[model samples]
Target: MVAGRRSGGRRADRGWTDDAARAGFLGVRATILPALLALGAAPVPADLLIRGAMVVTGSAAPFTGDVAVRGERIVAVGPRLSMRATRTVDAEGLVLAPGFIDPHTHVEDQLLGTDARARLLERFLMQGVTTAFIGNDGGGEADVRAVLASAAARPVGINYASYTGFGTIRRAVLGDADRAPTPAELAAMKALAARAMCDGALGLSSGLYYAPQRFAKTAEVAAVAAEAGRRGGFYDTHLRDESSYSIGLDSAVEEALAIGRASGAAVHIAHIKALGADVEGRAPNVIARIEAARAKGQRVTADQYPWDASGTSLVVALVPGWAQADGRAAMLARLSEARVKAEMQANLRRRGGAEKLLVTSGPIDVKGRTLAQIAAARRLDPVEAAIAVITREDPAVASFNQSERDIRAFMARPWVMTGSDASTGHPRAFGSFARKYAVYVRERRVLDLAGFVTRSSTLAADTFGLKDRGRIAPGAFADLVLFDPRSYAARATYAEPERTAAGVRMVLVNGRVAVEESRLTGVAAGRALRRMPREGTCPA
Candidate 1:
């Protein structure tokens, strides 16, 4: 799908670029030019024309201009452009910027095993996100080819690319055993990573904090991540620890930096933060380290959700990795024993408490309750209550452990791009990008509008090797978002996670109108972008 015929490649029957058809107008032009001039009937030749916009042309300040899209690419962008078009949008007071890209996402569920592809992607479309990079937290399927192939067959409205998850690949080869892989096993895992890259995966992703991945040491991870580096790809990681769980947050950052060095891959830390009460104000230390690495000419970048609380499973947030080494059955077995239960309760109490963990999904009756509240209601310990909850369906929790100060610190960094890391019960899945503009830019004035646009779109695209996206320029894909800063807001919250973002006026994916006049057209007008080595350079 990345290399062949695509779903949204067909053009509207405008024939604006047909030279032979235009050649017939030579004799007619003499007569028609004057009459048309007299009548002021010069036609605009474009599939869609966005005019009178304050265009923020990636990394630059906004300027008044017009942007013309013919078929799937922007044909012209300046003060004005002559074109014959059937459709034109009067963006007189609107801001025209590149469609936002979610650098980290978990849309595999929407793309696969569902008939409601349009419904799932509509939330992103409404937020002005035109692309989402799947395979975050090392949870995408191992076979990138098969997964992408299936997704392409059921094409959604937004573009998506994937990473070869080290967790998935490891499980396939070693079956969740905690020991380091054999030499043969390592070779097999490396081979899988290479194959995924060959089949159009963007890079390698790892959730080193989670089970199975925690079992493998640094050297074992390097062996697998090296394949991605060989293809000029990156190592995108959910760091070994976000809190003071095991290695501490700062040490976890060092481990990610070490992987980038060990594997020769450009390193990207997903959801960069100093999480939990023990490490509340340590974001600066992490930033200093990344800055030092960049000074040495090492490519180190990260993505962060703009929310205070980070979303994850109750299992990963509470249960120790050792207890969940094999699977759910194994973890439950440990929970059944008295000694293991006591140890787990102590661990949970030490790392904040049940009061901090707010359940977001599953068991509809207790959906918005905290673990402490659930424990009180059930007349049992919070750890025991959580263990009981995990066994039914592994519901997600919004652990309110992040610091506003640390979040502001990380957001101020140049290399940190916008990613939701959105899961069920998390409002970010529905509204992070819009909040960056509405809350961070207009009201808060964290950064200027241009800087925000650059971070949300262009920076992420270039860093991840996605070509011809994340900008509004000649020859770039016509993925554009039109909005009014005053009107736009991220409307989702913790209790109501299903709400859509407000005030994104229009969105164009591959020159096709997706969200028109603030509503969805339900057009599946996106492509599956593959990794392009030429676009993988960090900007100076």
Candidate 2:
């Protein structure tokens, strides 16, 4: 656990001195102190203070204490701070911790979209997530500079960082051909990854399970990833196979490790899971492999949402990657072929049949219905109905393929952090952190509060090199969440995916109140976080 330790005294006696606190307060102290001195008055020491909350510092065990914020940083953290503040909150019974950091999300559209209210990201705020990472699963745009620029132009309610995506780069250069990139094309792809890293992407992300990206061989991926790695970025990936599809789960893990080895990049598995019945109890084997690699000094880490069902598009869940080459139109045309239809039927059976696949979103009005239900209503075979649905619109599905046993196994690992893999039509988007607390931490005892806070915040911060975040301490960014432990729970369900969570009483982003008393304060204080390019990566 990443415990936040205070020096010079025991935990009970280690409160910040007034001079030290004022010095760290910087310009805020400079502006207010002299004026108050002229009037022979003492300046308020903090802009906002919360007293009597059980503080989970993301590093330290929970303790009843106070935290003071000045400007965008915390200046004081200890039990019973005596300094006065401009505003003080009585948080006698709530639990205060660093705001949850969602390491994987697909909210780029909502963040950069023109819809003002959507940009507030109230769902995440309600769930106590203050920071999210986007452009994941190899879907990030190669133009990192432009995306970050756009986000900066439009203020968002939550801070975010992004990764440049391999799928986008491959598509840009090879146009979904499902063939190995020629030498020049490979060089071009490498250049894009390098430029994205220099332009401030956190890393290179790949969804090898998705089309076009799946087409790239492991060597080709490593070559492209090496560009980001050499520039001091990690490689984040959705493995090419999480089940018995293509190379199988074990080989897919090996492929990811091989990429990390060949590219000299730290490997981060996105939404790590043993999907489908074929891979259901394989969590231990997978964890052992990653642990073995870590023992050999390879930096390997992963994140997982605490949900049994995984989310994906219907086509992605059932369609073969080889058939998806060239694009959707060609894939649709091939659906009529007898051989392709047979393969589709086999894939559907492997996925636990149509009953397990819940159609969540699309142009069709079948949201909340299963493919089996749709098949029966249309008087068609499940595979035929799925094809018909694809012909009209490719809908998203909630594939109930994961086992609770596997989820607990992965969650028990110290290296596994919390991530939502947030996307449209999935309950994980709005409820992952809350659900983790409610089900895993509070109920099942899979993790205690400190472990939850550590994985949800500190681990991601340390892994991604986010400075002064994921902890409650002097000089850390004042992103905090205060919630009623008794009531904190996920309200969203697979059926009601858009429902917000419950029991987050307040949230602070950059020392500004974004949510209070379980309501939005309409503050858009989030900054677009960018990794600084390594010293020689960019032009001087």
Candidate 3:
């Protein structure tokens, strides 16, 4: 009998279905029951059964089916299961797909913070993300084991993994100076990378666009990355330049490919994009470079967010890397100089002018205003106005620079996957996955439904070595998302960055319900997933 409630608020079992049930069981039981018998196994009752949903298995086409879950694994997946179930969900008219895995996120503060609501990570759960990777852009903690331990001590709502951050390692070993590490310092950094990998980090993650890391030469990065690579980990990086900030977009892509070759690791570029007016239409060129690398048998993949505006701090957006050496105090000291101010003004113009930069977070009055507006009100040049704001606090801004042409070109590639680059004061933090489904898949038709599911879940899982977590199959982890295709959409905007997405009907993490009926279930079923250390890498 049909059970529970349907999407349109109708009783699930309203229509009696003796004939329909018989038809559903005919071919399914004939095929499945004998195979179980041949294997000397019998069908057992399921802990939870979701019946009659359109299941979009990441590896296959969508089909109407039932998915059965035992304790923490999907025990059965097929058209019609006759086994008794402890509980059943009538998923009629809903789309059940593998929960999306976000490759980039900055929810560390919320995950590790003192606030109970924040710790639940309801924002991500609401976006239909069952698993997320943290410690991105070279900002992860150096002590990987400690971070995992601390996170596990509390109840979290979603599964997570992390990469050992190169920036953190550099800062730990060599402070924030724009210089190559000494031989001893380099060795020390390598040791730290090795330790982190052994302690369960996914790999070495670097933000070459930021300080200390930006100072390191290509060879230096390869040297540190080798430690993780030797232990069977891949290298994930935020390239040094997405536009013409330093090495140019094409050159940065080449550098990432080179690092992979030198270090013997696969390379995954984070938030791959052509930013700024200088390189707005360079997505095709970037794609060609990565494709060429792949043809040559090198492992290369990338992730892209759906938004045109990229989120970052004003300092990173405007200040020259050389001027940002040492720390905040030194950087502020240099910002006051005429030469540095001129350079900052030039950088601001290159990034599409003050009008394109919208301040998302900072002091009370400055939150939603554009840099141009702030400058006019303060009666100062845009550069000086930015300096004034930075002097008090380095606020985050949504820099509108990318073009729709570039965004669509990159997203259409099979190698490119979805990522939020999620951070505070950015709509992507709460709505990236939902927006991709709504705007790109549903509206723009950039990707079909199956394609979106594969990129968002399967590609990331396979690339990062996350086994049994991104597909719908027997013996896989029961991490799934059920949503109304008609209603799923992103609600968060630049002005209302904290608003969560809509239409995530249910979310399951490791066989536990984390969200039901688009609301958090107050179930923190998340676990800190650790990659098994390569044999002999860790001390016995």
Candidate 4:
């Protein structure tokens, strides 16, 4: 049985109902009391205590238990912990679980400017997330420590980690040019990547489908990835393509796999999904290929946002790749030219018209409107309308264009983990995890509670090598979430995108309470998690 001991106090309420008492109360009390005292005396009185709840510890199925937290670590886990604490959370009738980890996000630079950081952390807290991985699709700059230090000085609500963006590096060095790096430049890029890792980057991340990075040859990427591997870091990719765009999906997967094999780095596919209706159910084949790669001893994992349509720049929807190459200024210049506009119209027609495109960011007039509506009102063709709207307002308009079947198919995989792929202004930014449970788990019944938690919590921790976290275990980090499963749901929608999610009762980061009773506590207890030394290595 689990161990514990009685303290001087009456102890936290047992929470056992009259019926459950006969079934477990006495037996649990006998095992818990001494174990609690023993744990409390073992060099630390836990900073927090959560007792009498069902805990999904990430190691096994759910069980009724108590958890004790000392400083930032979970010191004891038993049926009822007796540690004295600065604060105690009553979790009766709640599910105590590992805090959700969003494995893919673009919150890095977004948080650096605007009021996005505070708002984004609020949204993440509402969804019961305690930690988030930013820099997906590889768009974060170096100066990792300085960036984190600045963020820390402000009161953020959740923990954060990041991947250094190869795309951003390419932009910094090459400035959106479509040319391969020279040997000296390549060495400089590698050195920058090494410094990022040393400064606490989780790994190297690349977005080959995006500008600058798209021009990089495989060898160029391999050189940087190899440096990350040598430094005990992992590699994550947004792949060269996901849709039926420049590179086919199969080719993109192969390219990512080849990079992992060549560099000896653990690789992850960021937001593994097939866009468009033409490629639905293609995930099974992709998973099989990933499995085959794993069988050959290549470490690979993937994360997915729980939605069909992805939010992104509108320039991608309307313009062909080569035409949009010069970034915003060049695209604006092209829009000003009558000849360039004519050629752009032809390209839009090739993609079966631009009627399906929608506007979601930038100017006020077009923020929530669609291209078809704008075109009809302006009395111009859809192409002209797209150009006018983008040029006058936002060059970047998010689109909704994924199949529902593809979403379900990908979430069913054992290896697939959860991510919002969202920033402050997006609905998913506030509602992703809650929506996954409310819509997919409760309403649709597509996945059970256990299955959903695994994908969103435990599996994410395992994939990212987050030690002593992602689970309610003895001697693990006290990053925990407590919520009402039946009542939990997301209220945010496209119209009211910044709304907080519903029914998350509490959240703890590193044994400190971050949220309580569905309200933020204004606590900033998170720390930058550096890479752990390898086995047999000297201490830092």
lDDT of 3 at 206: 96
Candidate 2 lDDT over 1-540, as tens digits, reads 112442111111111111012244464553444345345575557899899999999776799988888887776777876667999999999999998899999999999888878888998999899999999999888988887776567888988888999999999999989899999999999999988987778889999999989999999999999987787788999999999988999999999999999998889999999988788899999999999999999989999999999999989988888899999889998998898888888788778889999999975557889999999999999999999899988899999999899999999999999999998899999899999999999999999999999999988877777766788876677899999999999999999999999999999998899998999999988877777665666776
- Clashes per candidate, residues 3 or more apart or on different chains: 7, 2, 0, 12
Model 1: per-residue Cα lDDT over 1-540, one tens digit each: 001111122121110121012233332332233244235466436677788899987845678888777667666676765556678788998999988999898877886656755433988999899988889877766677776666456767887778889999999999888999989999999988888876667789999998888888999999899887867777999999888778888889889899899888989999998888788899999999999999999999999988888898888887777888888788887878777677667667645789888899887766899989999999988888988898787788888878878988898888999998877789999999888778788887887888898889978876765555777766566789999878888999888887999998999987788998899987887766656332333221
Best by TM-score: 2
Q: How far is candidate 1 from the true structure (C-alpha RMSD, Å)?
A: 7.4
The lDDT values for all models are 0.79, 0.86, 0.85, 0.71
**Where does the lowest 10-residue lDDT sum fall in candidate 1?**
12-21
Model 4 per-residue lDDT at 461: 73
The C-alpha stretches of model 3 lying farther than 4 A from their native spots are 1-42
**How well does model 1 score by local distance difference test?**
0.79
Q: What would the per-residue lDDT of candidate 4 be over residues 1-540, giving only the tens digit for each residue?
A: 243222111111111011011223433433444555665543345567787878777666677888877655566777866557766777889988888999887666544445634633778877889888777677866766665565544545566777788887777777777778888888888888877876667778998877768888888898888766766677899888776666777788988999988877789898888865445567777888898998988888888877655666666665656555667788687776777677666545433355555566776767677677778877888877887777765544445656687788878888788888886446787788999999899999888878888888877776666755677665555788899988888888876777889989988887678888989887766654555323232225
TM per candidate: 0.89, 0.93, 0.92, 0.86
User: Who wins the lDDT comparison?
Assistant: 2
Clash count, predicted structure 2: 2
Residue clash pairs of candidate 3: none
Task: Score candidate 4 by lDDT.
Answer: 0.71
